[model samples]
Target: MIIGIVGGILQGMEAVYLCKHAGYTSLVIDKNPKAPAMYLADRSETCDVLKEPERAKQIFSECDAVLPAVEDLEVLEFLDSAMKEVGKPFLFDLESYRTSCSKEKSNELMARLGTPIPQPWPECGFPIIVKPSSQSGSIGVSAVKNEEQRLRALEKVAKLNDTPIQQEFVSGKSVSIEVIGNGKTAKAYVTTEVVLDSNYDCKQVVCSSNILPEKDDKEFVEIGKALGEGIGLKALMDVEAIYTKKGLRVLEIDARIPSQTPACICAATGINLLEELVCSKLGKESGKVRKDGCAIYEHYVIRGSALYTCGEKEFSHVEAPEYIKDFWGADEAITDFKTGKYEWRATVIFTGKDYQDAVHKKKQFIKNAMDNCELEEYIDRTPEMV
Candidate 1:
């Protein structure tokens, strides 16, 4: 069957990869002609997803399903409406998509449903995480330390043209929940703890280091699965949570496959999200999947902007193998190439003896890689005392 895929950036590329991997033909559309996913797609159309619904519908008419790979909520919402009009295959109920797309609304829903969530406030809280409920890549997310900081942050975020939610910033270990949803049911694929590279914000996300299977928190997984099932999630979903003194509080619930999720889940477990997504769309039962050992996905954050000076010693040349594998003939990679504003992008997927060791190894790789590379202009943002 053919899948009509939308968006064509990094996340879009990943979605296309998954669809092709599942043996499905793909029709990809994006505004950028140089979108990475276009490289391997069966067919492509360069258009703005928001203004080209008719064009998208024409493309969707030839496909079995229309799937959105990007985190653009407006486009997804439009697609949802169009899917209803055409009576085509889409995973979730439109209402569920609406609820999940809004961070503020999702928090309200989950909280009312008895899911643990951090206290949310539109205002009146310091050290708050100011995030646009719909944006991704942590685009506008900021930690405000005081009232003055909150006012300044709000003013800055106001220019973004989206309503922002301010909530208490919980500092502790961060984890991600990956789930695949059939229209009626969703199963938790795996839970992984993520450590942001030291230069995480600069590179956007250099790489994800460790995927510690949450065998210890099966109940939490069950709860999240119920949450997805309750919401009628039909596609891939990712819930990011932070472990705080209060407990496990969900930070964000994305109704689409997360960026780098393949490296996080598929690399850790044998379950491929793309296959599961196809199965879900076809109403097939997803088999039981579990994580083995510990898997890591690490990437490097080269300099992006020339706002800050780069250290000459920061950039070094090292010979790293192009690929590494965990199973027989199962190709996994430590790094990949992307010609963005940065110099290099790599991710290493490997299992460790335990969580700590897994994290240690991942950090070691980042440190070593950074040590060898020369930092060019560092992005100048607000520097704080850590």
Candidate 2:
């Protein structure tokens, strides 16, 4: 069997490895040649999935399935259309996938479905969060404090050249819930809570994360299940929910695997999301996901620095999921009680004898990492209390 893996980020790499482990040869395509997943693929092609969908399809004529690992709504739409034309397992049903991919559509669907959501208006609160409806990676996201701030956010949205969604900011501890589904039945992995450094705002720079069960697991599970069914979504989903006065409310839903997937959720729970996704695509109901005993914490040692490269080309780095293996410059070594050009970000996974041991390990990891790194200025959001 041959599977086509889309996008070339951390999730893409993991997805390829999972497919290979499940006895399938994988072919990868990405716009960037340096994508880490490209290095691990059975065959790599240098073609834009969005710009050259026809060419991408030609390269994967032998593919039995197509899986997306990046956050490109346009590319997903194109792939969905192309897959239907060729008669292959597209995984996501067209309409449901689109609904989850768009912020505006997802918000409207949630409201119509009677799921609790923050009012989608900046006027509801100062320092509200405004971001593109179909974007990821904190790009074009801002905190609007007032009318002036709202205007600034609009300009930023225009600069991004995409329609943006304004969400009322909810201040509290933030957590990401990982869920796996086949668009009907679903199972949720451990809920991972993230705490930011004192200098770095929790809403801005995501500093550290750990696997901890939610106080209101039932509520979150109900909402997440409803969300997937409402949109006919399948595969991996991460919903960012915050605890507020009313209840635990969802900030946003990522239809794809999250950027923090490799570190926090996987570290805490032994559940391998990529493997489950591959199984689902094959229509094999093996009950493959497991979370019997797992404990993990992931932290990134962050530092502020100006651009240190000489070129007009785009530059990106791929770390070892959630560990410090090495640096771009071989001479630089990460040290304790030290801040250099690089930060010591790592994901520590250790099985616990009991539940208490898991929680204790998470807290200990945070304390140790915090002692080594210092936080500078963060994108702080001062939302007025409602």
Candidate 3:
């Protein structure tokens, strides 16, 4: 099968990665010639898809399905409409995207559905996290610790004229699960734990079996299904929640193929959401998706100055260069290695018989990698936190 993927930036890489593993050909499009996913795609074209959507559709006309792997809402709307006209499996739902686009809307929906969520702003008091209602991936997010900090964060939000959502600071391990559906049918997969940097932005993902407490499994899966059914989801999506002592506090829903979490899920579990979503749209048989073992995904970069790592895991979705395969127990390596360059970044995936085995392999592999390479100061991604 062939899939036409739009946007070769962040989320786009996973679409290509998943399809490649399934042995499906993928044609990727992005305006940037060096868009990270370009090298990994089976076929790639550099084009302004927003400007030349018709051209994109023509290029994608023969594909089995068209997938939008972009974060830009406008771009997704266009792709959804264009693919509708093309009469192929356009694997996204605009209404669902819109619902998840605004934090306020999603929070209200969850509350109405009787799902636990972070308490509202002042009612929950200081140390609340404030964020732009429509942003994703912790962009334009801030944790206000005091009245002064709250005032400053509010001013920052005012400068952008964006609606800010203040939620109680939820202290717990952040976890996300993937749900695939077509409104009438939705299925939630195993959970994956999110690793955060100091700024609370995702740095890596730990995909393992039974990451969620067995006690929370049924309720957590129910929350995902409730959101999917409420939003009438028609494709793949990720539901993020904080596993608090009380229960899973619904954080926010991203009604699109997420950038990092999905890949790790496949690594740890044997399920591939992309393949299932595509085949479902095509009305073809997609076999069961289940937990196979464990997988860990992390990122690092090598530059002439020093080796640095991505603040956003999988930020560099490149294949491993032949010179860089010293690490053992690595199930797969995708790196962006430019010729004669001092800088390069690649995401490495490792699979093991079980969770403990995978964690051990990751630690050993990272130790081997960092020790052999000359240390460049850690690539500190300055907090985009407001």
- Give the runs in model 2 whose Cα sits over 4 Å from its true position: 17-26, 49-55, 120-127, 162-164, 180-187, 195-215, 262-264, 294-316, 319-386
lDDT for residue 13 in candidate 3, whole number 0-100: 80
Predicted candidate 1 versus true structure: per-residue lDDT over 79-149, tens digit per residue? 88888777778744556667777887898878777887777765436567777776665667778788788
Instruction: Choose 2 or 3, whichever is better by lDDT.
Output: 3
How much lDDT does each candidate structure score? Answer: 0.62, 0.59, 0.77
Q: What is candidate 2's lDDT per residue for 1-386, written digit by digit as tens?
A: 67788887656765655555466777878898877667667777878977887888776666887777766667778887888787877655556556766778888888887887777783476658888887665568787788888888888888877897888887776666766677777766556664433322231112122232345766777777777777667676777778677677787777775544434334334455665665776767656554555443332334352111110011124332321232221111112223454532222343354446655654554444444344333222222211
Of 1 and 3, which scores higher on lDDT? 3
What value of lDDT does candidate 1 attain over all alpha carbons?
0.62
- What TM-score would every model get versus the actual structure? 0.73, 0.69, 0.91
Ranking by TM-score: 3, 1, 2
TM-score of 3: 0.91
Tens digits of per-residue lDDT for model 3 on 153-262?
87777776789888799888889988887878777776888878776767678887677777797878888888888778888778998998887898899888887777
Residue 266 lDDT, candidate 2, scale 0-100: 42
Query: Stretches of candidate 1 above 4 Å error?
Result: 47-55, 81-88, 91-93, 121-126, 197-216, 301-342, 351-386
Top candidate when judged by lDDT against the true structure: 3
